[model samples]
Target: MSDRITIKFNAAQFLTSAPTLKHCPPDTGAEVAFAGRSNAGKSSAINTLTQQKKLARTSKTPGRTQLINFFTLGEEQTRLVDLPGYGFAKVPLEQKLEWQKHLAKYLEERKSLKGLVLVSDIRHPLQEFDRMMIQWAEDSQMPLHILLTKADKLKKGPAKNTMLDVKRALKDFQGEASVQTFSALKKEGLDQLKSRLTEWLTPDEADQAIEELIDQDSE
Candidate 1:
């Protein structure tokens, strides 16, 4: 985390009012999400990102995270939501649709959602479902930062190539985007993510920093 940034942590189980497009944890602050396929290391990535081992529960079995779990940063100044993983699971199609519905409601209606921290296995980066989630974030006009998980399982060259491929995938999507290789097992890339997260959590300061950058460019 940035030395200059103040951080707060809280959590809640917010429900999405079905067919009505309402989501819980209704506080106006920047929200980011960690999304991916079940068993794609989403919970592990989240736990690593927050520096909290159990912040997001991890299960070897798929379909464990059925509801939206919210983790607050900066005391609601920002939220890091753990959205249930989608695709390649044993859940029934109708239930999957509801999950999609629930997620859609939050993405479209949650004014606080500022960014999405998409997690994907490096072995199969930008899988079909991953692309769809990225599309949702783009359509919602939220920034996206992809976490290429399981980096330690690959050779360094392959890992670099995977990162390159993931970046290319985002080119088809619009809005601000970035990619960072991560290994929850090794806890690599935590500091980079923390710094970027701090900026995302603090929009006013981020905006000021951007303005200063623009001024410097002009000068």
Candidate 2:
């Protein structure tokens, strides 16, 4: 079995915000991106995952995150990206289109992107924009993990049913796809999220050994 590195998500720090793909940091190392519609609890889930109250900046107003925000983990090269929330942002049509263009460019061309975490409200899983994202991921053959946020709002049975329904819906997706219920308020399903991220972000055993050796030499 291959060894895995434990990621320290609490150590995550704000890296930078890029308005477009061209302004993003160098395309090196692995990164996972989080995308969701406005008011989908995406920021809250990120904050919960990082064990920070305001890591991703939660606001009562929907669509406060306008740029592609990047956060660095314990490893400088490893990163978590927050893509701009789509649909329901109170921006002009031209601005929304511009944002979509940049978002598409990043998703299509970012070489360092290892996977995408698509957040949705558990009560309203797979909205119009959500399905579009899933389709895009399928077309690009990108690994997609769906987080049905706000699961605490529903009863246990409903939550499980919603998750199961989502899983069934995605069975036809040709690419790697998965769905899980999550609740930032309750920190429910946090461990599962971390496990998925670790699987995507952790380097292989050989790479880890090399990195360990480099660190030891530096020390």
Candidate 3:
């Protein structure tokens, strides 16, 4: 296998926000999406990953991220998607359903989606909505990386155990799955998360060489 490319997450910039899959940018590039329940630190993780203080807005009120937001790396074809937060009880049932419908359509139909990052609070991991996401990824044969956010809130021992427990719980998923502890405040597990995203979004050396050759020929 060819060597993998390194991605500069810090350079990520807002691309666009789409209310539904139809509004999304043309589906022709590799993108990994982040999903989690409202106030579960999903936005924090995104900001931390990109080393940007405000790449994704962190709201005190839950369910504020009603749209699917997209961020592009140096290349438009490499992207990181911030999906709408789920399981916000304050939202009306109809609105919640609408968000879920759009989310499902994007996950099920987006050809450029390469993987998923499911963020959950380390203190309360694997809630109902999180399990639903895991099942969806398994059914779709999509690779998933679970981020146990807020690791700084717990003692080291408990945090480690939580990571292990989450891994054991997902042993039956049958698709590519991994778990790690993270703390946006502490900047913990940032490298691991970056590595996973890079693996998903970066094209290998062979593909890069071919693209370069094609560009040269076109010129």
TM-score of each: 0.83, 0.91, 0.92
Please give, for residues 1-219, the per-residue lDDT of candidate 1 as tens digits: 344455443233232322323546675667777789887899888777666787788887787667777766646556788888865778789988878887877887787777788888999888887888888888898888898899999989999998998787677777999999999999898878876776777667676687689889999
Residue 205 CA error for candidate 2 (Å)? Answer: 4.5
RMSD of each: 6.3, 3.6, 2.8
Candidate 3 residue-wise lDDT, 37-127, digit = tens: 9888999999999989899999988888899999998888899999998677587898888888888888899989999999999999999
Ranking by TM-score: 3, 2, 1
RMSD of 1: 6.3
List the candidate 2 regions with Cα displacement exceeding 4 Å: 205-219
Clashes of each: 2, 0, 0
lDDT (CA) per prediction: 0.77, 0.91, 0.91
Instruction: Give the C-alpha miss distance for residue 97 in model 3, angstroms.
Output: 1.4
TM-score of 1: 0.83
Report the number of backbone clashes for model 3: 0
Model 1 pairs whose backbones collide: 8-74, 8-75
Clashing pairs in 2: none
